[model samples]
Target: MNLAGRKVLVLGLGDTGLSMAKWLARRGASVRVADTRTGPPRLAELKRSLPSVPANSGPFRDEMFADIDLVAVSPGVPLAEPSVRRALDADIEVVGDIELFAQALPERHARIIAVTGTNGKSTVTSLAGAMARAAGVDCEVAGNIGPAVLDALMRREDAGRAAGLWVLEVSSFQLETTASLAADAATVLNVTEDHLDRYRSIDDYARAKARVFSGDGIQVLNRDDPRSLAMALPGRKTSTFGLDAPRHAEDWGLLERGGEPWLAQGANALLAVREMKLAGLHNAANALAALALCRALGLPLQPLLAALREFKGLPHRVELIGEADGVRWYDDSKGTNVGSTVAALVGLARLDSKLVLIAGGDGKGQDFSPLKEAVARSAREMVLIGRDALLIEAAVAGAGVPIRRAASMDQAVALAAQAARPGDAVLLSPACASFDMFRDYRHRGEVFRLAVERVIDAPKH
Candidate 1:
C-alpha cells in the first residue's frame, strides 16, 4: 500500500482514470495518463487540475507499460487491450479504482456494502445508502452509481469527515481488476447475459461479478437467480432474497397476508408490497436485497423499512413518466440488455392489459430469444429502433405480437402510443446499448420522456 515514489500508468482518462491519477499523485506516486481517444471527455479537466502529470492520447503503445510499477485501468478499457495484456505479462500490478479504494479502506475506517449484478445495482446501492443515512449513519454511495470511489474518498479527506459506511454499485467491469475489496456485506443481485462484446461468454461475465464476495463478508444472494446462488462459497455466512417466501430465519422474501404480497424476513411479514413507492416486483426484490445488505451490518430494521417505503426508485429504470388516454408511459431506457428488458416486461405484466414495448438499440450481442416468452405474455405490440432492430425483430418474430420499426425515438413513441389501448402501457425499455442512436441511456430516456410529453399534450386526439 506504500505508493510513495512508485510509477503508475493511468489508462483511459475518464472520470475513473482522472480520479486514479489524482489519488496516486497525492500519495506521491509518479502518474502518467494514456487514453485511446485523442480527446477523452475529461482530458481538459485533467490538464487544468494536474498540469504536471504527463498524458498521451490515441492508440496505446508498448512503451507506456515500460518501468511502470502499477497500471490503474478504467473499467471502460478492457484488459484484453494489447498494452494492458503486455503489462500483465510483465508482472506489472494492474488494478482499477475500486481496488485502490479497497486498499485505502483502513485509513477511511469505513465499512463497505458492495452491490453488483447486470441489473438493479444502482437501485439497491441507493436504497442501502438511504437506509444507513436514515438510521443517522454517515454514509456515502459511490463506485459505479455516483462519483468514483477515489474521488469520494478524497472529498471526505479534504473535508476532514470520517468515513462511516460506503455503499458501492460495482459493475462487472470494475470487478475485473478488483481483488481485495473485502466488503462488510456484499450481494450479486443477479447475473444475466450482458456486456458479451467484452467478455468471452456469460460465464466470464458472471465470474467477474463473483469477485465482490472475495472477502469473508456476509453474502446476500438472489434465490431466484441460479447464477447468483452459485456464487455462495463454502463456510461463508450467506442470506438470500427472492419473490417467494423465505425458508430461513435470516433470509428475506415475500409472504401472503390477506391475499396480498408482503415483504418479509422468514415467516414474519414486515411491510405490504403496496406500501412501497417503487413499482414492479423486480423493485420489491431489489428492496429485499437492500434490506438484507443493510441488515447484515446490523442496521436497524425500522429505518431500513422506512427508506424502502420512501424510496422512489432511480430514473430511466421502469420510471412512470406520463399517462395519456389512460395509457401509462414508462421510461426504462436503462434496460440496456436482454435480461433487464425481460425483467421490466415480466415485472409489469398485467392480466387486464398488455404493454406496447419500444425496444432496440445496439443489442450488445445478447441472445434475444429469452425475450420471446416475456413479450408474448406481456406485450400487445412492439416498436423497434436503433442499429439492431432487425435482429430483435427476428428473435421475437413468433411472439404473437405485432412488430413495427421506427427511424427515431419520436417515431417510436408515436407508434407505441398508437398501438396502446386505454388500459395498456407504453414502455421504452430498449434491450440494447444506446450508443447506436443516442449519447447514452440517460439521453435516450430523456428523449423518450420528451416525446411522451408531446403525446400527453397533443390535444387528446
Candidate 2:
C-alpha cells in the first residue's frame, strides 16, 4: 500500500477520482488524472483542489498508461475499458477509491456499516446513520451516497471522536476494486439485473455485489432475494430481513398482532408498522435492513425504532410531491433500474385506486419484461419518455392499458394529469437511468416536480 515514489494514474475526475488524487498526492505518490470527457464543469475546481497532480481531461492516450505503476479508476469509468485493459496487460495494479480507503482503514477510527444493492442502498445507509445519531452516537454517512469515503474518514479523524460510526452506501462498481474492506457490519439489501453495460451478465453483477461479504464481518442478508442469500459467506454470523415472518432467532420481519403489522425481530415486536413515516412494502424492507445493521453493530433497539418512526423518506424515491384535484403525484426518479421501478409499482398499487405511470429512459441494457405484471395491475395509463420508451412499451405490450408518448416532462405531466382520475396516483418512476433525457436522476425529478407545479397552478376551466 506504500505509494511513496510510485507513479499512479487516477482515471476519471469525479468525486472518487478527485478524492483519491488528493489523497495519493498527500502521500507523496506521483499522481496524474485522465478522463474521456473534455473539461467537465468542475475541472477547474478539481485542478485547484489537486494542484500538485497533473491532468489529461481529453481522450485517454496509450502513452498515458506507459510506465504507470497503478491505475485508480472511478466507478463511472468501465473497468473493461481499453485504458484499464492496457494497465492489466502491463501488469500495473488497478484499484479504486474504495480500495485505497479500505487499505487506509485497518486501524480505523470509526466502526463501519456498508450497505450495497441495486436499489435502496442510500435509504438504508441514511437510516442507519440516523438511528445511530438518535442513540447519541457520533455518526457520519458517506461513500456512494455523497461525500467520498476517504474524505469521510478524514472528517471522522478531524473530530477525533473515540466511538464514531460510518454508515456507507457502497456500489457494485466501487466494490469491484475493493478487496480488504472489513466492515463491522455489511449488507446487500437486494441484487437484481443492473449495470449490464459495465458487467458481462447478471451473475457477474451479483458477484460484484457479493464482495461486501468478503471480510469477516456480521452479514445482514435479504431472505427474499435469492441472489442476496446466495452471496452469504460460509460460517459468518448472519441476520436476515424480509416481508415474511422471521424463521430464525436473529432475523427481522413483519408479524401481525391484533390484525396490525409490526416490525419484529423473531417473535418480539419492536415497532408497529403503522407508525413508520415511509410508505410502501419496499420501504418497510429498507427499515428492516437498517434495523438489522443496527442490531449487528449493537445500537439500542428503542432509539433505532424511534428514528425509523420519525425519519422522513429520502427525496426522489417514492417521495410524495403533492395532491391536486384529488389525484396524488409521486416522484420516484431514483427508480433507475427494473427492480426499483417494480417495487414502486407493486408497493403503491391499490385495489381501489389506479396509477398513471410516467416511465422510460436509458435501459442500461436491462430487460424490462419484469415490469409488465406490475404495470398491468396498477397503471390506468402509461406515459412514456426518453430514449428507451419504445423498448419499455413493447415489454409491456397489450396489457389493456392505454399508452401515450410525450415530447417533454411538461407534456408528460399534462397527459398524465388528463388521464388521472380522483383517487388515482400519477407516478414518475422511470426504471432506467436519466442520462438519456436529463443531467441525472435528481435533475429529472426536479423537472417533473416543476411540471406538476405548473399544472397545479394553472387555472381550471
Candidate 3:
C-alpha cells in the first residue's frame, strides 16, 4: 500500500477524485487530477483540497500513462468508455476510491462493515451507523451514503483519533475495481439483476457485489433472497437473516405475533416489534441486519433497542406521503430494480386487498416477468409512466390487468388517485431508474410528495 516514489493519476475531479488525489499525494505519490468538465468553477472545492496539483482538465492524456504506476478512478466515470478502456490497456493499475481508502486504514482492531444492494443500501448503512453510535462505540460511517470515505479517513488522521468501526455503503461500480479490500464484516442485503447495460451479464454484477466481503470475515446475508442464499460464501462464519429468522446471534429479525413485532433469538423472545419507530417490514429487515451486525461485534443490545425506538427513517424509501379518504400514498422511488420493487410489494398488507401500483421508468435491461407477476397478484390497477412505459405495460397487459398511462408524475399521481378507492394503496415503486422523467430518485420522490400534498391539501368540499 506504500505509495512512495510511485506516480498515480486520478480520473475525474469530483469528491472521490479529490480525496484520492489528496491521499495519494500525502503518501508521496505524484498525482494528476483530471476531469471532463474543464473549468475552475467545475472543481473549486477540490482545488481548495489540493492547491499544489494544478487541476488538469480534459480526458486522460496518453503521455500521463507513460510513467504512471496506477490510476484510481472516480465512481462517476463509466469503465466502458474508450478513454478509460485505453488507460486500462496501458497496464496501469486501476482501483476505486474505496480501495484507496482501504489501503490507508489500520490492518487490525477496526471492523469495516461494507453493505451493498440495489436498494436500501443507504438506509441500512445509515441505520447501522446510528445503531453503532448509539451503543457508545467509536464508529464512523461513510462511503456512498453521503460523506466521502476519504473525508472520513482524513477525520481519523487528526491528532489523537481513536480506533473505531467503519461502516461503508458501497455500489456495484465501486466493488468492480475494489480488490484487496477485506472487510471484517459485510452484508449483501439482497441481489437482483441490475445495471445490465454496464456488465456482460447479471452474474458479473452479482460477483462484483459479492467481492465486497472477504472469504475469511463474517458474511451477513438475506435468507429470503434465493440468489444470496445460493452463493457459496466460503471461509467465513455465516450470519444469516430473513423475515422469519430469530433475533439471535448469526440470525436476527422481529417476528409478528398477535399484531406485534417480536424480536426472537432461535425460539427465545428478546423484545417486542411494537417498540420500534421504523415503519413497514423492509425497515424491520434493516433493523434486524443492524442488530445482527452489533451482535457479531458483541456490542450490548440495549443501545440498539434505544436506537430502534427512536430512529424514524430516510427519504424515498416507501415513505408515507399522505393518507386521504382512507387511501394511502407511498413513495418508494428507491426501488430502482424489479427485485427491490418485489421486496416492497411483499411487505405491504391490505385489508380489502386493493393496491394501485405506479411503475415504469428508464429501462435497465432487467427481466420484467417477476415484476409483472408481483403486480398482477397485488395490484387492483396499474399506473405506468416514464420512458419504459411500453415495456412495463407489455409485461403486465397479458395478465388481464387494467393500466392507466401518463406523461408525467403529476398526471400519473392524479390518475392513480382518481383510479383508487377507500382502503386502496397507491405505491410509486418504479422498478426502473428516474433519470428519464426527473433529475434523480430524490427529485422523483419529491415530485411524488408534492402530488400527494396537492391531494391532501385540496378543499374538503
Candidate 4:
C-alpha cells in the first residue's frame, strides 16, 4: 500500500488496471502496466490516457513479478493466471483495486459499507450509497457499481471532501483478490450456483463472497438465504434481514397493509418505503438491504428512500426502454444467470399469463429447471437466443410452454415485440452467459436495448 517509490507492476491495461497504474504513479510509485490483450481497443485508450506510466506488452515477464513490491490485478483475471501464479511463486503481494483504495484511505476516509453477492450487489450497494447521500452525508460510491475505486478516491480527494462514507458493490472476483480490503459493515445478500467455470466449486464462490466480511466489519446477512444464514464470522456481529425473517426485520422493506411502501424496523413506527419507479419485488429486497445498512450506520432512511424513488436504476438490469402500443418493453441484459433472471422477472412484477420472455445465452454449468418452471408458469411465450438457447428451450418445453428460437438477440427482440400484445410485458432476461455471441453482459444489454428501441420505434404496427 505504501507505494512511495515502490515498483508496482499492474498486470492488465484494462480500465481498472490503467486507473490503478495512474494512481500509483501519481503517488510516486514506479508503475509498469502490461496487458496480454495488447491489440485490444482499450490498449490505445489506456496509452493515451496514462501516457505517463511505463508500459509493456506480451505475457507477464518473470522480472515483472519477481521484484515488484505488489501486483494489483484486474478482477476479471482469474487467480490461477500465469502472472498471478508467478507473483505467488515470488512471494510478492497480490491485491485488487479494492485493497489499494482501502490502503490509500485517509484516517477518516469514511466507514465502508460493502455489499457482495452473485446477484443484487449493484442494487443494494447503490441503495446504501443513495441512503447515505439522502441522510446528507457525503459519500464516495464506487467499486462494482461505477468508477474504479481509485478513480472515486481521486475525485473525492480533488473535491477536498474526500470521504465521509464509502459504499461499494464488491464482486466475488474482486473479493477473491482483496485480502486487505475491509469495510465497517458488509452484506452477503444470497449465494447460489454461479461462475463454476472459473471457481473450484460453489463453496469456493461462497468463500470468496465471505471475504467481504474479512475487514473485521459488521456482517449483514440475508436470513432468507441458507448460504448467507450458514456463514460464520467470529469478529463480526451478524444482523440478518429478508422478507421471511421470523420477526420482521427492524431494517427491512415491506409492502404496507395495502399497496404502500414501508420499512418496518421493530415496534417503532413503520418507515414508509420509497415509492420506487424501479419495478419488482427483488428491488424491494434491494431497498431493504440498503435500509439495513442505513440503520447499521445510524442514519435516517427518509432521504435514502427519496433518493431511491428517483434512482432510474443501473443500465441493463431491468431497464425500461419504451412502450409500443400498450406493451411495455424491458431490457434485462444483465440477467446472465438464473438468479439474476429471476430477480429481473420478479422486479418487473409481471404475472405469468401476460408475459413474453426472451432468454438464452452462453450456458455455464447450471440447470435451467427453476427458470424453466418460472417461464412455464409466468410466461405466455418464450423467445430463446444465445449458445444455450436450445437447453433453455428444452427445459421450458418440458414444462409445456411454447418457445421460439432466434438467430440473434435482435431477431429475438423483434419477434417478442411482434408477438407481444398491448397490456403485456416483453422482457429480455437471458438466464445464461453472454460470451457465446457478445463480449459481456453489458454488450448483451446494449444489443437488447437497441433491439427494443427498434421494435418500439418501428412505425406503429
- Which candidate has the top score in TM-score? 1
Model 1: ten consecutive residues of lowest lDDT: 345-354
- Model 1, stretches more than 4 Å misplaced? none
Candidate 1 global CA lDDT score:
0.93
Task: Pick the winner on TM-score between candidates 1 and 3.
Answer: 1
TM-score of each: 0.99, 0.96, 0.92, 0.91
Cα displacement (angstroms), candidate 3, residue 166, comes to: 0.7
For residues 229-271, could you state the per-residue lDDT of candidate 1 as single tens digits?
9998999999999999999999999999999999999999999
Rank order (by TM-score, best first): 1, 2, 3, 4
Tens digit of lDDT per residue, candidate 2, span 125-232?
999999999988888888999899877776666677544787888999999988888899999989888889888998999999989877788999999999898777
1 or 4, which is superior by lDDT? Answer: 1
Worst 10 residues of 3 by lDDT: 345-354
> Which candidate tops lDDT?
1
Report lDDT per candidate. 0.93, 0.88, 0.79, 0.77
Task: Give the Å error, residue 107, model 3.
Answer: 6.0
Clashing pairs in 2: none
Q: Give a tens-digit lDDT track for model 3, residues 1-461.
A: 88888888788876778777877888898887777776633377766766777567876577766677888888877778676788788767888889888876765357788888776788888888888899897888899886889877876786458558999999988887787777877888888878888889878888888887754677788877776666546666778777785655547765667776676656655667657666567777777777777677777888877887888778888877788898988899988888788777766643335778899898788877787677777788888998888888887767767998998888988889888889888899999999998888999999989988997787887
Q: Higher lDDT: candidate 1 or 3?
A: 1
lDDT of 4 by residue, 1-461 (tens): 56888888887777788778878877888787777775643677766767777677777677666568888888877879976886777788888888888777746557889889988888788778777887998887898887888888887777777678889888898887777667788888988878888988889899899888876777788877789878867766667776542264453535454565455555343544445766666776777777777778878766766777787777777877777688888878788788888667655644323778898887688777778656656677889987888787766667666788999888998888768877889888888888889998888888888888877677863
lDDT of 1 at 28: 96
